[model samples]
Target: MYSKNVPSGFPRGFLWGGATAANQVEGAWNIAGKGISTAEVVKRSTNRKDFTMNQITKQSLTAAINDSSTTTYPKRRGVDFYHHYKEDIKLFAEMGFKAYRLSIAWTRIFPNGDEAEPNEQGLLFYDHAFETCCKYGIEPVVTISHYEMPLGLTLKNNGWAARETINEYTKFTKVLFERYRGIVKYWLTFNEINAAVWGFNGTGALDDDLPNDQKMQLRYQALHHQFIASALAVLQCHKLDPEAKIGCMLARMQTYAKTPAPLDVRAAQLQDQLNLFFTDVQVRGEYPNYMNRYFYDNGIELKFAADDEEILAKGKVDYLSFSYYMSTVTADDNNITKATGNFALGEANPYLTSSEWGWQIDPVGLRIALNELWDRYQIPLFIVENGLGAVDELTPDRKIHDDYRIDYLRKHIIQMKEAIQDGVELIGYTTWGPIDLISASTSEMAKRYGFIYVDQDDEGRGSLTRIRKDSFYWFKKVIASNGREV
Candidate 1:
């Protein structure tokens, strides 16, 4: 898969890799001293068109927790990666991955999120996983807390809205830093940190029935606690391993104006600012000026400790990392047609195509996002997650000819190269899911995004076999030639 002609701007040693989350990929939700997580109780949405947060009231959560049916709760039986880590990492090594981005399930370590001592079994699990990656020369980029908060935290402290949750999370981070200091060098403080403000289901909030004002307040308060936790985690990571690189992860919903009208432009800018606010706090270590007005106008007051500002300043991240699967356009008018993708909604872009899931396919927007992030933070940016989620049919011979996924990835990689040429300091690119796992949004296996396919369905029935797709070989070549053989 090597090309004689290498890409011009792709510097040598550019980290090419894949990404997965514990809740989305790893099964064994109840094994190895792992506690139940908020992700486990999230029921699948029947209506795909309107992917709102599943109604997660206390009663529903309790029922789902006690429910013994893995078929109904598919996340409970992910891809069984917990038991198949060695086999999966071998495949990643076969693809010549420079880095593998995966999250450490918080519950795996803490079990209940406030434990006085870490679970040795959970620590040993990651210790062996990272050791295998190191054996294959694959760097592990670990997300400290990726959506899989222990359900106990939500029930006990109302998730991150309570001030005590911050201390608990800091304790979790301290354990991680002290334990995995040598094995994992790259760290992400939170996965999609802004989702709490956006009311995403995985932000550790289980009460979707609250009033709008109360909901907004809760979301922002949780966001504030997460911000403090992220900062403190960065500080803790540096204290443990000075060579470690910590970053803040954002959803990166790049928005464009529909027209040249000032209102339209302002709308797009405001939408972009709303998405960038999370990264702004982490990278700059201070809240952006515009957020004060936003808070006041919305009647949202954030509680902060006296030393929170100082802690944030001291704990600024070393890089900016984000997941960019699609972009959205915004118009000033209220009657504009809307498109949804990656948990964000916006006006549809008539100029661009869309994925089967209605995610706008704008390769150029990736270049725009990279340039914007680089210009804003003046720090290295990592493309932690980007991929197409589509249905795949296995032929009788057990093969998948997914040219659409190949095209999506090729176009994005080309745009990433263009961005690098345009002076964006990019650290690496890790496609969202290297192997097919349970979909985060709908909890369906059919919404596949991977070079490798796992034999599973939405109803939790399959032989649990792993097969390499055509794009798997294609990606191996791309990585081998350093993005030259697309």
Candidate 2:
């Protein structure tokens, strides 16, 4: 298949761009009336094991909040995107970005979760940012909350555990919808609503010392609240601007069976079912029946309001979007040699190679995932986050030759085109961290994912310069050619 081949190339007006999160990109954390966020409390960790819940302790979190050291908490520095967004957006425009997917920091607006008024300064920042995107002929695809929430919500409103966050999140969305309704047509309710199953990331400021069972219960309950909140956000967006579209995002860790054994196949099926439950509630407008048995077995009784089901049905997402970092293999046994993936827990596949961070590379898995999602849900799909994270070396000539990233993306894009040829109605593909920003899992700047290289390091040193890598030029051509040149 080549550029002349129909359905192999991207469709007309297909958005080619990049994605970043506010808590991971924007520094000036406390400068412009920004309230503390749970992201700020998350200390830096280079060790992959430390990226888990083990590192998030009362002692560590308390010190991170009080100490306020950018070196220790690299996310606090975040490549200084707050000051350099103009330069960054210019770079994106140069790369011919038809769209730029970025999230709004909730604390930036509310300062605290339970505020009566939004911070004017925070509102102004995004207002200018959106205007700049429009000025550069780039469409801004916005995410409401991307893995970070106001610390005030955790401390006071009890985070997502309490149903109060549903109303609070609606308030935040209402402000955003009303503020930039026309400029930003595409919206995502949450970055990865399903990741709540693996708790403590965005669920709020619950004590890390809680029992395992209690923690699981809290996460599901919080996820329930968010489902309602997302539904409410859908209604708000429609009422504010009928032309706009709102979608739900999933960290779609496509799962595979470790072997063809019946037990392994069944285990993988069960895992996939559980993973799809998040989108089921959002898209199909009700939780699936299997959840009843799972919840009963797990002692998780989700409380629901009288009108929750009605609200869910009324606010079905306009589209379905997701991030596909890597896929995993599941087996029936518990003691299998596990993959080094920090997020999606699974056994390593023998046929796959891993990145520097241990995430398996699976281009074919993306095609399978696209077919599965298209058949499962008939709505248009968007690959809002897909990229390679590797350590790049800048040559003495101030050039970064990151052909590894280019190869990774090219393979994924080829599979994406195959899926489109399979008749999957994919609308867009935005590679994650188009510019170098802090890593969400490890909070390390060294684990870079940008086509454009950042000058900063893990300790937050360097001039914070934005230099285009070899992948940058390669991607520029990819976009200009509409996925044909790659």
Candidate 3:
């Protein structure tokens, strides 16, 4: 879309690729010694607007676990990436991907999360996957724990709400670091760790009827335990693989003021601060002063271990990675047109267009997010996830023409280039799941967000074939030109 007159700002070796979580892409959830994950039992909603909560309760989870078929549980039958890794990675190589951001299924490594010995078959699976990625010259960027946690952990102590899961998680990370020491250098401790604020963090919190104050208390407490665990994992990664880099991931929610009113501006500022509170803790090695007042006013009390502060201070993340898809504006008014997208609520931004799912499209918001984060942290940033989820169609000739997806990404990449010129040290951009995988929130194949289209229905019926959309070649060109062609 840009002419040669606009100089490209993307850095050399700027890891260009795609991202996918284990739970969202990898099927075979209960095979080869892989245990059930918290993400496994939750069912998808028929309504596009409704989403799946982290429903890891005792009764519902038990019933869902007993059923072996993946017909209703669409996530259990992903795009079948587990069986198609070699093919998928080969396709990525064809597109000249420099990196592939993916996650390890915790259940596959530690069947019950507290197991002493690791699962060899599960370990072997990833070994082959990583070796294949390396063979194709793709750097493997792995998230130690994505949205899925071993359901066994949740059943035992309600997942991260208790202190025990932290140790189990660290043990899992130690296994990964020792096994894939030289192969995987870029690591993320958690996927969207800040999602814990809403209790839909996928950390295995029991999702059921609960009082508002109690739920918030439990969510904050669970998030604290995760902070401790992440710090511990950071320390372990450094100790084991001295050359490795460990980071914290957040689902960034960029906010804007709906009007120039002073209260509205302040509301936007406070919301953005609260959204970035996770980065302040992980990147700055301590909680911000603002959250103290938040916790006090909300009647939320956090219990910390004796050595928690020391661990956090000693093991700060080397980088900060985040997923930025959409942004919303906020106002101080009690009632207005509410914005709903990517699990955030605010005033609808009339200045931006909306995606098919009503996510307000604000390419400039990405530039704003990058500048704000870089100015605050001053460390390298990685955009691990960004894409549009839409209903794709396959033509009679077996071709998918998705120009809308191309336009969405093209605008965002341009904004990223602008941010780089503005002095944001960007590590790379990995659009979420280059191949179409089941949606994590809604678990629908119809909500496709990929350059490669998978022939799978929301009901888990199709050839499971992978076809490249027009955007696939467009992205290939963008990568080849290092964002100059876009």
Identify the runs in model 1 with alpha carbons over 4 angstroms from their true place: 1-7, 53-55, 200-202
Error of 2 at 353 (Å): 0.8
* TM-score, per-candidate, Cα-based: 0.97, 0.97, 0.97
State candidate 3's TM-score: 0.97
lDDT at position 325, candidate 1: 89
Worst 10 residues of 1 by lDDT: 46-55
Give the per-residue lDDT digits (tens) of candidate 3, residues 49-80: 66435444567777887887687777787888
Error of 3 at 65 (Å): 2.4
Clashes of each: 0, 0, 1
Model 3, C-alpha of 93: deviation from truth (Å): 0.6
Per-residue lDDT of candidate 2, residues 292-410 (tens digit): 98999999998999999999999999999999988999999998777765468898888999998888999999999999999999999999999988989999999999989999999
Whole-model lDDT, model 3 = 0.88
